[model samples]
Target chain A: MNGVHDLGGSDGHGPINPEPNEPVFHAEWEKRVFGMFLPVAACGYFNLDEFRHAIERMGAPSYLNTSYYEHWLHAFETLLVEKGALSAAELAARQQQIAEEAR
Target chain B: MASSAHTRPLSEVEIRVKALESLLVEKGLIDLAAVDALIDKYEHKVGPRNGARVVARAWVDPAYKARLLSHGTEAIAELGYTGMQGEDMVVVENTPEVHNVLVCTLCSCYPWPTLGLPPVWYKSAPYRSRVVIDPRGVLQEFGLQLPESTEVRVWDSTSEVRYMVLPERPPGTEHLSEDELAALVTRDAMIGVTKVSA
Candidate 1:
């Protein structure tokens, strides 16, 4: 897939600013997303390539704008729904519920 | 942050992740203990220190260096760093005449079992796209000005093979022990953006 994620040889993105004393994760949610990787993969929802492809399949706008763990979150959402592990509706409903609870 | 767009709030992402995790847990697809264990291992136990140790040993042992250069995965496994993204490894050595660097232009494919999760910049578009086309320029941006005599080699990691730079052992380190030598190896050096300084 010739998605925006294949950024090789492209230009005009800007300078690479390396962070000093960067943490392992930027946010708690990122930690949660990272933690979920092995468990989800262990249960056989998706393989590594499938997971990468899910990320690659993301829309260009969001793919470039979102954080790294957000990409992982997107992959889990995309693959789990596509793999029949959960329905899209169920994911939406759960997301809504989580949003409400947070408020 | 370089751009305002990069500063998007994490709340929405948090909500989405929470929802996904809750659903997975409810369906018995996720194990909380396993998740915790993985986090602890990555956050505390495993990291670039593993790769540093490997580089240090290779610097001291000629036979090990030969083996590491020839059979990266097996040699790295000898030091207990093998699995996941690191299953297929290639250790590129930096010498006086040649320098090497690693990147995954397509995605953030890194050696997790060895170097741990990559930094944010390594996964970002700027570093990915620019490095391949302008290796010397990007290396300059990293404050690593190479002489015209040195040839730069950039290895873009594919899904199958990951790369780690075996940085040249700096001068005046002959007295240092392997452990002490490992202490001098930084993550950036192993990634070949910068040299290991004594």
Candidate 2:
């Protein structure tokens, strides 16, 4: 079997190359949401001060479990529902409308 | 940091914010240069030095390394840097025998507290898939050549948690102080592609 590095190239095996300096929508959102939700998430779940202390303690990970965009989507969805900005039913309805519109 | 108020997807709030940005560009409520300046300011001021300090400390102190492995964030705060992106972190250590590497396989889960923003490569799918399977080869591309006997461990970062690598300290630095040790801790070392050198 080919190693992981061998997977991205023109033959549809390797990873596709993105344009240099391209602005990524997902990453932009991830950075925004990370900055926004981290404080609240830390305070409500883990101890706020302790949480900050822990983060400065390590280096980068080998892999991320979810896409950066997913984190933004997750945080946004959670906060929207929590703050009554959008009800679960409304979200479901909007998703259905979008899906139907696509069809 | 702003409150978690704009989390919803495709909502009116986000649209309004975008619209406002556009309007500011059109009507000059805010200059584009000023906005760019603000972004740069935060990116630099709140970036990953805190995490780098932790990695540097672990390199110099064995006991601190033990503490970092057990309780990463708390261990880091012992050095007096706290708040923001560092609320949650996990420490993965590398040794001469077993090298630890980091990749954001899914998207770009990074230890923002220490490292600041994830580099563009970390967020790319190619780096994510390639690193986990052929870490030695990837390291080679990054100008790192490891022995075959060195085992590679790849950690996957998630939304709830982040990770950082504690690279082994290089030789010829026994006489160096902690501040000197910190200088040797390059961003690549913390990512596990390179080791600290004299």
Interface root mean square deviation per prediction: 5.6, 11.0
Tell me the spans in candidate 2 whose CA falls farther than 4 Å from its real position. Answer: A1-103, B1-41
Best by lDDT: 1
- Which portions of model 1 show Cα errors greater than 4 Å? B1-10
Residue A79 of model 1, lDDT score: 88
Candidate 1 is graded, for docking, as: medium
Give each candidate's fraction of reference contacts reproduced: 0.79, 0.04
lDDT of 2 by residue, A1-103 (tens): 2332222221322542434443323344344444444333432433433333233222234113344444344444545455554466766665555434333
Fnat for model 2 comes to: 0.04
lDDT of 2 by residue, B47-150 (tens): 55566678777867789989999998899779775564567878888887888888765445676657766666676666776776777777876778988888
